[model samples]
Target: MITLKFKKFNIEAYKPGKSRVKKLRKVIKLSANESALGLSPKVKRLISNKKLILDKYPDGKSKDLRKAISKTYNCNFEKIICGAGSDEVIQMICQLFLNPKDEVVLPEYSFLMYRIYSKVVGAKVVFSKEINFKISIKEILKKVNKKTKIVFIANPNNPTGTYLTKKEVLELRKKLNKNILLVIDDAYAEYMKNSDYSSGLNLFKNKDNVFILRTFSKIFGLASLRVGWGYGSKKIIDRLNLIKPPFNVNRIAQLAAVEALKDKKFVNRSIKHNFFYANKIKKFLEKYNIFSNTVSANFLFLNFEKCRYSSNFFYQKLKSKGIILRSTKDGYHINNRLRLTIGSSKENLKFMNTVKGIFD
Candidate 1:
């Protein structure tokens, strides 16, 4: 048996939403931060057209889709690389950069994938302390040293939905050494309406050491397709390409993502719906004396401190009632908190009604 060295690392505990929902005949899943609005009709048609190409191998270079993304973002084609998902892109970055004992820095309460990938690459993972679920730049700066190879900042961070301001991002970028690779994971960038929110792509234009990561999973409603891309200087992109497997992304995913990018109407509608439903859920949570941060993303993090139930207990209770939510513990400490995905109006109402029953 070929055993991995880090076999002892405990897999992050995720709330068992899928298995729990299997037992419930009628389950409303609001756990994973997937877009509740379905994929665009154009993308569906593109997939239908590409079904015939399944017998052939995918384009090894993904040239056309790369061009599409490059054109959309107004960046050079040499600076972009597509992957199975943003997760795959992250893994590639780790493989290309991290040695056995190099250090990786990120916020304590951010996305779980950052930690998972760091360990997979045999890097020493150091977490900066979080303040109200947001990344504190001072804490991050304190943790940085000569050993730090890469630093990941998930803007509008997962679970918490907190983001860094443009000024904060620039300040951090300036303070970091030129050799350190700063990856700005903008997986939820599309949902942000604030003009001051740094997209990370701006850093790429100014600094050779910066890279911006994005995904089609959220705003484009193509989570199942798993299309992700990154933008950086040609040097960094070329380095990442060294470890990326040929044809890492599939044909259908490329086609769907290309079409989805062109579907501006669908993108607009999804953004509009996200803003509308997020406010509704916030108001509902407030009525129950439950407080949550006002996030500029498609998901809401509901802290259950006022309800007197542990997050795990509340998650189980919600699951039993046919409402699925994400629960975290151990490394991810939000006290008693549940991350809820904003869904369609009907789905949102169903989730709200189910929660109201629990509170009442």
Candidate 2:
């Protein structure tokens, strides 16, 4: 037999939140951290109006969407570069900055994509230590070296739902080497209503090394359309635009994104729902002694490391009840943790009752 030869990079593929449960009639999927409210009806109505344009090639530059986003966020449009999602934009950044044996620094239990993308380009992945699920900038500084090319910080980090304040982030920038690129991934920024938390977008204005990433997938509820964009210095934005494929964002997605940005009412509703229900769920689980850290994002990360039941036990029990949640063991590298998305009011109530039954 002839030997088959293929060059495969050494890296773990990004594991998305678990979904697709079969044989469950009333399955409430709270695994992906997706918006329970979903896309606004106004977006659907606008998309429906644009049915005639589906036959044509989309605007390659995504000019309209960029303008809309810039207006909504009150940022400079020249610094904007859109992509299929934050994932693709991050891939582009890695390919541009990383070489074989180069290094990327990130916190432990952070978003997996940063590590996976860095490794895909043959770059070394370095993990910084965390304190009680919060990223320690001191630990991150210790990990950075001459080989480090990029630093990825997920504000309101996933699987933990904790955040660093603006002052803390600025201190990180001051301490890092000027040559290294700093990427701020703010996928959950919209869900957060706190004044103390900042997306670090201002860094893009003054710092040539800073890049701020935002997504329409989370608060805009356009996960299916996959619209993500980044803000950086003009030079960096120009480089990314050069490498970004023409028509990377489809016409439909672009249109929907513009309308989604304009619908302030919808965003307000989603924020309210997330806060009210996330707190409600956390309080309800208190009787079980299942505690979650204060979360600014749209999900609650319940720590079951010392609970009456193992994480796997609670997962299987909920799965059997037609309820689904995200476990952190396999993908997130955290044990005895479950991430529960703040679903609609009805779904949240159902979840509370269903979970309470397990203790009974």
In terms of lDDT, the best-performing candidate is 2
* Residue 277 lDDT, candidate 1, scale 0-100: 88
Give the per-residue lDDT digits (tens) of candidate 2, residues 1-360. Answer: 999996567777666776766786668889888988988999989877834488789998899999998888888899899999887899889988899999999999899889988888889999999999999999999999999999999998997999998888999999999999999999998887778888777445557899988889999999988889988888998998888988899888898999999899999999998988888888888889888979599998888865898888999998888888998886677888898898888889889999889998
Root-mean-square deviation (CA) per prediction: 2.3, 1.4
**Tens digit of per-residue lDDT, candidate 1, span 134-249:** 88989998999999999999988887888899999988888887899999999998899878886887556656788888999889988888889988888878888777898888
Worst 10 residues of 1 by lDDT: 10-19
For candidate 2, what is the TM-score? 0.97
Measured with C-alpha atoms, the lDDT of residue 109 in candidate 2 is 82
TM-score of each: 0.93, 0.97
The TM-score, computed over Cα atoms with residue i paired to residue i, of candidate 1 is 0.93
